[model samples]
Target: MVQEIRWGIVGLGSIAHTFAKDLALVTGGTLTAVASRSLEKAKAFAGEYGVAHTFDTYDALFESKEVDVVYIATPHTSHEALSIRAMENGKHVLCEKPMGVNPDQVARMIAVAEKNKVFLMEALWSRFNPSIRKAKQLVESGEIGSVGFVHADFAFYALNRDPDNRLLNPDLAGGSLLDIGIYPIFLSYLLLGMPKNIQASSHLYKTGVEMQTSMIFDYEGAQAILYSGLNSKSEMKAEISGSEGSIFLSPRWHEAQGYSIEKEGELVDYNLPTKGKGYTYEIEEVHSCLASGKVQSSMWSHRNSVDLARLLYEVRQKSNIIFPFEQQKEGV
Candidate 1:
């Protein structure tokens, strides 16, 4: 029998709480420890999750001999550093999406992971979503007959948030593109691959952060119209159209609970809801890869993460949406 994997969660925030709760439903995996900058916060999260270890410093958690993997759930700017440190400590890492602020940091993280021979995966939970999987299967099976266009958007109003909040803080890599824009980017990559040409526009807040971003991805035979925002709420549905038919994802498509395919004007519905915060699927994949001694995932490889980051970098460059950190980091 394969042994279970033990997890050490870095950054004890609300999202980490949700992740801890979901870990309860995963077999062969357990939340063994939690770390935060504050002892109080770490102890609180550990107590709530029934975790045995709680540390005030990330270094302690990363260096812990008990932890087999570390889930880097910190803010966007911190992801690269934390993942690299964990991997350097001989622990696998599942970092939250947009993996790094830019492609360069992502490249460095991948290199370190490869050098250390440790498993590393971006926490793009949407790829493993059942509805998304089903949609991909239909597309690959020729049910859609050569996709010509893909449209997806993820948006919600966040203008009321405080300037100090990560959503509005430029120093923290705060912006619609990194925060919510990644979902649309991921969908586009999944369907259209990397676009040969890219055009983008953004509406920046007075704080110099993007409030909304719209991107056009031009491929060999198809195009994708993607948008993400903190200015308005969208239907949040996704569509992939081809010569023969199209597939429509249910509302909140990124976390797809169901999807429908239309062919010759006939629509067929497929519903598959997930449990908890929808992280169990990726958790299972982590366990599977670990058991196989794989250093990266086939579904969300390090290269894929780097590609997505590079695309975002290009989009930001075109839209004049550079973050403050870009100036601090040379050659960003």
Candidate 2:
């Protein structure tokens, strides 16, 4: 039998809760520790997940010998510092998306991980979705016939809540583009690769953050029309059209339970049932890579994380959306 991989969750936030629940259903994985700034939250999370340890501080968890891998679920601004610290403590890291506020921080995290000879990955969970995998397979098999155009959007209304929430707080790197917008941006990179050129526009909130944003990614013969916002809901389905036909991801494409293919005037739909909050697949990938002694996954490597960060940084530049943390870097 394969030895179980012990995992630590650093941050008992909403997303962390989802990950912990999903970890329960995955083989070769167990939630061994949880950490949070608040002792109460950490203790509660540990009890709920039956985790063996709880730490009031992330540093405490990182130093725990029981945790072999640490999942960094903190805000975008804290990802780089926390992940690098975890690596320094000899722990593998799977950090949340937008890995950092910008490319520089991501580069630092990657450098630290490489220096430590530890495994590291950005938790872009959508890449592990079965429906997404099928879409990639269809495109690669020439079923899409030279993909030409792609369209995707992710949006929701979240402006009425606390103004201090992460979405509106520039200090926390808040904005639709970095938050909800990353889903569409990631989908574009997955199917279309990085665009050769780009143009973007945005509507800024009173808090000096982007409320809604749209962009067109231009390739040699293909283009991607993508949009994200915090003002309203969008259809959330994604389509990739080529010379022949297209693939349409079911509604809530990022968390899709199904997908459809339109080819030769025929339509076929597929259902993909997942075991948990859709995190089981990524957790499985982690287990497979660790068992093989691989440092980075071919599916989601350091290069992919860097490329995605650069693309977002460029897009934010075009949209004139700058995070306060970015300004701090410039000052330094």
TM-scores of all candidate predictions against the true structure: 0.98, 0.98
Q: Which candidate is the best by lDDT?
A: 1
lDDT for 77 (candidate 2): 86
lDDT of 2 by residue, 226-258 (tens): 999999999999999999999999989998898
Clashing pairs in 2: none
Candidate 1 residue-wise lDDT at 30: 91
lDDT of each: 0.91, 0.90
Off by over 4 Å in 1: none
Score candidate 2 by TM-score against the native. Answer: 0.98
Number of clashing pairs, model 1? 0
